[model samples]
Target: MLRELRWLMAGALATTLAACSPGDTELLAPRATARAPGRATTQQENLQAFARVYGYVRWFHPTDAASRTDWRALAAIGVAQVRDAATLDELRTRLVELFGPLAPRLDLWIDGESTPAPGPTPQGRDTMVYWQHEGYVGTRLSLYAPPYGQVRVNAEGPHRRRFTQAPAPDARVEVELVPGLHLRLPTVLSPADAEHDGEAPLDDAGLAHAARSASGYHDLDVRQGAVIEVWNVFRHFYPYQDTVEIDWPGLLAQALADAENDRTVDDTAATLWTLVHALQDGHGMVGHREIAARGRLPVRVEMVDGVPTVTGTDDPSHFAIGDVIEAVDGVALAPRVAHLADRLSGSPQWRRFRAASWESLTGPRDAAATVKLRRGRRALEVDAHFNASEPAQPPRPPQLHRFDDGTYYVDLTRAQYEDLEPALPEIAAAPAVVFDMRGYPSNTHKILAHLLREEENADWMHVPQVLAPDGHIVGWDPIGWHVRPAEPHVQGKLTFLIDAEAISYAESILGYVEAHDLGTLVGTPSAGANGDIVRVDTLGGFFVIFTGMKVTRHDGSRFHVEGVQPKVAAAPTLAGLAAGRDEVLEAGLANARTP
Candidate 1:
């Protein structure tokens, strides 16, 4: 089962501004080592390292794919890169080259009024240096082989600290405390998102969540670079906002008018969610709380040639596939979609590109009245009951089944935790458990904890970094998590399942299982949103969330947006919800059933 986590880390101007004085050896690295590590690690090491970092960049980087997959494909390129490198320094060079090539594709993902002029990088240097949050730079770690790598933070920091344990073959310890300060979102304040500028006329630091020095993976401190990444996501502001001037009420008014005029609450939510995602703060988000209790449309629809076409859903009586939607209750489809497109297009956050995030704009829209549809070109109206939505929660509950063939399956959401609980004993009776966490957990920590408990420890949780509003750094120290903390379940052998829906906290759950050898993962990578997600209200009532931390595995793999990969990858097929049909689930079951 999962633990409910709600601890906040404390941040102060002193802690955020500087972790330690130069007199002490602050966990950072000293000057140059060998320029090249010609005999460091293997090619797999390089590939895995680069691949992991690249995955983290998927959510954090500000560019798009070479095609409409602008973000995905660009992130995928990191795979080929690590496979080709011979040494650590070479890895760094390869990354520079890889990102450099993406300069032209920049506009494909960048959100701005006009494309900037063609020019060399801002530094005028041959090598392209990445702008992480704060003053952090993406550079090489001499400790590894050539084609040097990224994310080895031991190079230089506010102070120098030494390692007590031996370094791994691929490990090059380094750290650097970035200069300047990070811009915390308005959520940390009492009014929460009062100003458009992160620091709008707020004199009291007590009201906000302050940025503080990081309590790293083990003993490392890479906090500043994290804030830097959070600050410039999607290039909301370049060079950094020297001064703060946020328009609270104005932004809220715009968001509401934009959302209500569009017709569907889902559309509006996606627009705001896109903006929060741009910031890349894991904590930033917008979701409806009603999807769990309220019934879902039996009809599944997708936009085809700018029209709503039925895809699939649980409801059998609704309609057949390929049926075009004419209207909802009494509303028409074409006009509504057109208007929605316009409203979404008007928002700078959602319009800058085309991708999964962009493509999802048309789905699960709220229907105030019955919807009308054109099935197979025949006009028909489908009544979809709708209501005013609440806030975001995990996913809705899933259907579960236990086959006499020694297999178990479930489609779970937060609401279904109780119903699912009574069936656990039956599930455990199966020869193998095919645990599916393809997405975020519906419940905060109930169902997960029930099925997977062998032991529980407090170490699994996080140390909150409490902050004040107004962008002032505050000083606070670290301790292990105070809440649902670390408690590992060493019970039954498990095989986890996933798809695109598996993301963020769910990904973290997957990682925990993988790291401890609890089970074998089978599926595609998850939605890597495993940071401290903060949901803050805007000036009036608008709310937004963004990714916050730069979380890497204890071993250094990244998970910003790129998901976790399964141990045995399933070949994609056309099986629709059948047990013997889906390769991903079958593979997971096979792995679970194995000795």
Candidate 2:
């Protein structure tokens, strides 16, 4: 009856394990006891069983399983069962009955069975445990560490710092917390021997064992290949290092660790994004199609009067326009915005623009968000569900607006500069022209060409060329864009309407207009990330987009971080928004009439 009970429990365990995805299991290196090729003792057999059972539970069970089952207690019972078995076959049968069908996934090899070749391990004598906790990174001696030992910790982020410790026999040293974007803990020690090699070189049998160990898991080979390729490509072509402040070695180490433990492509993509954002390059992005079309919250939150308020909503039943959000997922709105800002790449202005919206905080459809909001001084907490439906079409700005005062308004977001070819005659006839550059333009050169008066001065843009992998700027190719002598160009006063949304190509044009005194810029600062983008693909089917070219004005001043400065800085007031008044556009129109 006891034997039958054991079999019943084992079969139940198999059913539960089967429900999990193959990638959900924790992976372990193959371990074969180094002993003579003879019959194993009961004690030895039980120890081997204990190792396998421990590994199986750690990888296969839910992270919060301790509350559900006393895992250690189950392993103790299994160990006793193996020890009491009379023979090797009896021990194997006992393990098989205890673990059921899931026994094979553990990759455990008992005594006398060929052990797998050991993989590489970090060299050290002390036991080290490295982890990231609550935005802090640190390392300490593992619980299994020796009473007295030396520990050295190296942390790399925006800066570098090293800490060495000679701890008291009983107390572990507390590391001083220094803020950084990323952290690394090097010199993890092995408790066995300080000089002892952690892994032995593997033979063909070991290689086969490794492959078998990874059979059911995601293709680690492909992920590692992608990591290597990204490392190589970034080293060769990346042009802007001064703007990118990151610890590459530390980040790559974390990335490799993620590749080993990541369960899905989304998991890997998030890890890669964290690395890409470290550069603070606005073009830096890492994702796939699935991530691109991922669901968003059905509301748009805008920064109004320095407060995050619901400016629009797709689902009016759950949220209302004008509702001010106070917190997200129990975290205060300020801290949440700060945390999200860390995930984005750009200047402080650009980061604010990217993270100011509720869409930036949304995740997949199943990811429910808890939001605390205030409406007319009444505060309430609501569980907001994500919208799986396609997003509604955004309102398109007017292509061109003609005023009764003979002033022409050209919306750069909707109308390309080439679209202005037919309107040039009308533009030249007008007293003043307002180029609505509140958003990005399709082509910067096409619009800026009309503003240049001289042929030699037409060449205003310079792009960096890569000749070597050493990261030093090799050469610069000056690009010339000449305007046609069609109808004598617009000789009237020109005013550009720009704001935080004006970015990339828009800023490119703004820089040109500012350089040659071509036009007066009005409104808020532009998004600081500029230049062309370079896209890279990894073996794991993830793609990263980063700034590939270095863009500067004719005067050699940088457009990165230091965006186009407007002559008339203005933004919309809360009252203005409530009244549906375009304050920035009014400011631009005022500038157009300035003497």
Candidate 3:
């Protein structure tokens, strides 16, 4: 089961903006060892801390002043200044400088604002230190109002303290009071705070029950729980956030209303699906579990000559390989595909592929679908019944194909790492090799090692870090994936064959290949959904896995929406399939064999 996470941190403004002040440090560096006052254990930790402060103030501050500021620019610029911070005090100084401009607008600073005299003092009930609304996980607040005597505080300062030990009933303590000023600290949710297991999580059946219940669906807790969870974790602004139009708050409100009115799980799923479509994210999924269990059409179809054609089928009624589908259930295939594009995520090519694929596999289960087909020059209509049974598998075992021309072909989906290990020497010595990535790969790293140049540092990936919990991408930080190819690195041309099915790990591995100029990419573009995914369970048992990071090529070009484009793009044609040819493979082979 995939677990959800909660972030605990405060937000603040940066103050290190003066020309006289030293420049910001390199926040993007993997490691930094500089030392100064108030130093965080690591530079990354310091950035995280800084981000928390920035976010807390920018988003949660009582006043709207922080909202008006250029926070994005503040973070971008402040990261550079803080890189040189040797101590926490030094980091604080930078923060003061960064926030200096907004100081007047914010009432957060203690008068004279200088660092408080080092250490503790006692005060009475009227005086408070700091206050903010407490945080919550799912629906559970972080606050635990234990028996009065159950907790104690280590007063670090008049306004700063730490939990020490359990206190006795009616325990009274004193702290030095700042004259004329004080702050109340609200119970804020800690990073370790978890969603309470109060109401048992709904199972699939329970989910269906909830969806159909007028009272349960309209219940505030149910609707808010779903919205809050998504708001806390969804990386809404990655890759295409700037281009995609999404009014997140508005959608949440609409979803709540829709959920209340929904009469079935499918209706609720459709509402949730709309929320995903708003972002145009390839990683978007809402009700996959229930949908996947619904049986699909027995035949496999491919987009050929811009038309969906039957490629293979075990239970052939009227459908046969090379039969071009013109329409389904009275709807024109092309127009239906175009209309469904909004519901699918990724680039135009990926959208087309998914839409066509969905149409090929979709229909009323146990009922017949009328498919209009054009087999060569003849047009025919047939009632095709979806296969309720599991799809059949090939009897012959998976193996690598070694051609007479000395080129090797391997379908990564069917082949394993061990299957390729024994042939590494010959594969390296061959004139060219083709890696068919038209399906999911069981492994990638080990095979990738054979293609990468040893000790090469390329801009291969990016991961988003949460500075605050606003349910949106705050920053996309570039990270490194250094390559060190195994002994006897392949000297021959490497060709990667990809299509709509090549996704996630497939697209990720392709990033390194394309970035380093390691091979030729032949075949249609990929699914364009490549990133580490974080799985989320909605109000009902519906599961959604979204891209948790922003991935890009070395050139900083995004791979999330615009998948790695093929150097030589080609699609399988019906004529080629009819003649028993793998056109995609042939294209790759031809490209490799050429000068």
Candidate 4:
């Protein structure tokens, strides 16, 4: 009944509000109340049910995705969840059960510290609602960092900003899991507050200085942290063939210093992010894993021809549509986008990734924003309105191409497994096969399950874990798991078409193809931002991804961060895409023709 109710609420909310603007102030229509929680859910008793899933993934979870947790990660998840929730009661009960009582991580002292503080009452009498599960977490980013700092966040893939709220902050926000059920940490100061508390925010010049300092240590690679170490250690029993040099002692020292810094958590987070970014790998990352984890502005928007166009907001009473968005907070989106594009341009196959990632955020991708706009040369403040986009048109679904030489090329999307799986036996009869796994799995687990299982797995089980800077693996278990598919297709010379985008579960796909010898893996080194991949549900600027475990591969090793390397590599470019060239696929085809 409890499970059903949870689903009912989630589904009801989704279905009821899918088309409604998140900024809409219309109260959700109330229904006949279920029996009071004390009478109904109270009987089902167990504090575990109400807590955020972070703890489950921290200790008992398996895969090396959500690498580790420091105070920021722990506190962020707790506060972030309640902030995203739809009701205050649900927030209160959940908070009480988690930080108040059933806190799995008791050492952080969350249970006692998360007590109620007074706030304005319904009638403005100044009494706080002790439990507000839903309303507490809803897009109001109750957490964030100082300005001018960066954060190192690891995720399996990028997220879509079509349906949620604005972003929290541009400053760094570092997080990682530690061993044990540690208690919650307190919310520290954001930039404005931090500066008020005698902390100075880093500026562009400061970033350059910090970057230079970190370069003496490790080049800033986004995929440098989180589950990467676990993958490095477990996947190869110490990869790199030689003893890779890591600042183990330095890592431990830093984690402690970060947690107790006088500079403030947000400032500290920003500093850590700068260091992580210095690693200089596409896969390496340092920032919020989930969009809902932070605060955001009030605007709805979309990118039109590389320009931010505001469409709507909750209170158009302040700012509305037709405004051209130029900046967020104080940072210009165009400059950031340009900077990222410049960084991406240096990659071996810059064109494809640059194009894909850029287009991913460009025109027509639904956007909600709080912004500074310039329309007809007049600057204005506006909240952009958003609407779901029609499915992107250019990457037209591929049609299967059958070659007369017993080689078959079946166009595949990560989600289109059922389309090709049934024809696998026919494919096995062929001499060569190609699987294009350039994207993450889109279909629910059912299709992926069928393609991956060698023997039908009755119970779907996988674990998610985070590796700390010191290399300790922390874990969690996702609650809902589907059955694994029992059948796997031909073990022939399969060549997979991968790019920077194939990360997380998609990166795990590389392990499966390589380990099972389903084919010769071909592509560039992945973007490497693997782990408990975050996704679209984040309300504010928080990248709220799937903070749970994913279905793993055979050896129980599901390291997502460092990404799978291509057996042969090719990089893409904007110029190349315009010419209708797929260098990676061509190279893959060349690799497959080994006579």
Candidate 5:
């Protein structure tokens, strides 16, 4: 009987996981646990049930009560009230007791019982109220505004009456379809609260206090609430829900279970990190001050010959270029890299690159680090020091360097568009040009204008017009930059140096290049995530940032995990590092020199 109830609850949550399709019963199956009967598993199940309903009421219930209530406080209170529910009946009663005030029209019942009929539609209202978002970023500050216009159609037109009158709220009802699943049907229109309307702006101190005073820092309810809040946000608004291969219901269940065991702020952060990492979004991150402030070694590492090899450094006395790192502070290099990579979100290459570069080298500020290195068959132990902040790299090569062979090398990663504008004539006259894009670019996309012979409209980003819950895209707003022809069209061959570090804006420029065949891309494929980021603050003070829009190739094909692939594959070699050679740049130069 208990097993049957668990399966029913799983089915209910699965319906809410992604409303675009039927629930995957296999993926949502209850975990096979060998542990003795305890509250841990029960609390996980309870929270999962609570989260399913929480999303419906918080986003879909159009009432003055729900609009005006403090959602963060409600999440904490709801988690506390429902975490110990022993049966489906108890869960239904507790949900009603907690949400009845906000959602007077909410209905829940067992699958075998007769369901309640919806309230009668209000007179003289032909259209139902529902949510329509042009681009729902996130609510960080009441005064915070996006550069691009964000429109919430819920507060405009006939929907405005739903928030001011009780009958308008009572005209529509949210019902449970699969016993535990609570969602408004597609035919029903349920308006969301006005985006950040009437909310007072939170100053830094106010934000801190609000985070601390929300059921206390150590409270398990608060921890679980944090997980619930973040999970629901992604469950409903994440653009790549259909594109990625995550087990959504299982992910929520595991996150709630992990939150149950959280004892410290770091532990809670880890749980949140794990949740976000499953998205495979390069922009995904959990912001915690302590973790951000950790010290880093003053050297850059990369995978060379399948080993962690030092490639760049500010402190050469402790480590040299091409030195193979075997271990760090008594932990094997492979395990350390794996641990960091597991928590990072992105394509395989990007995750590995980031983990190897700086994340694995981070430790307490000003702490001593013991590193084991292999140099020319000699194994040596070296004591290294961590910097209080990210150590500055050695001075970059000239932004625009003219090679002896009349080839121009432009470092887009460091060269500002303003600085490069005047040099366009010089670059155009060169026999060939190599544009370095191994890292994020500095608004140099403007250069595309000079390379083009005519106007080109490349609509690469698709902003979802989310109307219902669970990321139902009613439509998409196609958006991208436009480029027009300018003076001094480059007669020289063009080549772009790229690697996994190239992401977001960098990928945008590369996407344009790929679409127009403007240049030959050299080096490895870029990070497979793109789109403007949206940062959502959780009740527990930790915030998560992820891609808020769907970015695609110029031809409108999928571009999330498949990033911009290179036409010519190249990577740095240990021997090249030992000899102070930039192999990727060399490859770009060679490609530029061709034809």
Candidate 6:
């Protein structure tokens, strides 16, 4: 079962901003127009221009008209409206027509035209309204809390003036968005008055009506719009923008091109998958039910002795334990593994583990394929049936296990707080204890209380506070776990087992243990991705999930792709698997028994 992070931060600013200097207003001013390349020659180029302008107006423009509009529907309608323009002037007219209603102040012109001057600063109102974000995760963010806000700033107060605003709608400050297109969308304005703007605010009824009338994923235009929407969200709000090395603009161009050629929903999904894979984020996933429900081989494969070896299976007729899978469907398993890995997002170990485990053998639902396997000295060809339903697994062991030697073991992956609460006395009294974290854990992190001697606070996750466009993080609000000591402290020697499957909340617990020297870690490095997930449903049919916050080590070292490493490294071997031994767990047990 997947555990969702439910805690949310609600308060005023956590940090103070330095006073803005008069000269700092230049940061908000629009840039001068660049030399025009020529008219847009392709549909991709026109859509690219539309995407840039759409993001600017949707996120930065602060008018009530823009706020209440159904942005997803508008994106689809906008794509259909502007994608066929053959010249720069045509594109400009379409863009203005599409966005001018939502942002009445919006202006667009050809590159060589005369540039518009800045609007005069307001005379009476001392407060300026601008955007402030604590954890901007796109449209789906409202499900948790409001991540975006229109903050009121006093002109004479001590605050960062990173964004400049035009005083009124008539201001014509222009900046070049693409080679041939230039745009002017004011970032600041006076309070929106529907009567003054000559356009009534879109009520809930109108918003719903617009959404019903707009195009959906069935249309190629809407699919392209979805790509643009997703690309802009990551480009501007992803927390790890500085950590991950991604050619964002190039990626957007490629995604747009791929979407243009997409013939089926699956093709669009694959395109989106490739785009998210570049983040290398463990939490990143494309939410498509059909794709997710694809069939899987019955055997559980893992890298053992540097080969893809089957470790677990209830049906031995096809392949027994310790069988090396050399090829599937005539393709070598090595290249297939690499190909599957390339489409996933995560740290190197995590990606490789997933690719080698189940993804390499996955195919269409209820399909049968030939597998070439080596059982010891004999090579055999077998027909492997793909189970559309989840593969049957061995029965789970007791959550709390006890050995004859007075050592206690708990599988955090299987044990919840309720199950372990009754066994705390036995666990605390034992001479040694081992905790297995080889996979995602239930709500078992609270077990930390019994292991700690005092209150411990691990403030490792930082939520970005964005005040400007293009991922400009002005500040960060830290969020983390706070554990307090409880009765019946576990005096026994502690050991933890971990591997690449341990991610997010698992890493969070391990990070605390490593920082406080509370236990001994044994096994391979963890998955290396940690942070609460932020899921966004696009105007398109599907939704995207990704890390919403930035995470670091307790002492402020990089931890995005560098998960917690164990002091004692160990992995399963072919010999161990054939002998039915859990080598990693044995290693942890060995450490627990020492001293």
**Which candidate wins on lDDT?**
6
- Candidate 4 lDDT tens digits, 310-378: 433444565444455576656777665555544331233332343323322332224565567675557
Better of 1 and 5 by TM-score: 5
Of the pair 4 and 5, which is ahead by lDDT? 5
lDDT assessment of candidate 1: 0.37
For every model in order, what is the number of clashing pairs? 110, 1, 50, 106, 0, 1
1 or 2, greater by TM-score: 2
Model 3 vs. true fold: TM: 0.62
Reference-based lDDT, each prediction: 0.37, 0.52, 0.52, 0.36, 0.70, 0.71
TM agreement with the true structure for every prediction: 0.41, 0.57, 0.62, 0.38, 0.84, 0.84
Residue-level lDDT of model 2, residues 136-198, one tens digit each, is 011222443211111122212211111222111111111101110000111122222122221
> Ranking by lDDT, best first?
6, 5, 3, 2, 1, 4
- Per-residue error for 345 in candidate 2, Å, reads 1.4
Query: What TM-score number comes out for model 1?
Result: 0.41
The model with the greatest TM-score is 5
Question: What is the Å distance of residue 266 in model 1 from its true position?
Answer: 12
Predicted candidate 1 versus true structure: per-residue lDDT over 322-354, tens digit per residue: 566675555565566555434332122122111
For 1-595, candidate 5 gives per-residue lDDT tens digits of 3322322232122122222223311134322332221222256666877787777767655455555667777777778778787766667667667766565544554543333444444333333444445555585544645422232234443443212112232323233432343433222334432232332122234333444562344677777777888898887788898898788788888887887788876788889988899999988888766677789888888888788888878888878888898998998997778787889998888888888986778888889999999886789999987783653342346989999999999999899999898999999999999998888887798888888888988788887765456556556777778788888888799999899989888998888888889889999999988887888877766788988889988888899979889999999887887788888887888888877
lDDT of 2 at 108: 27
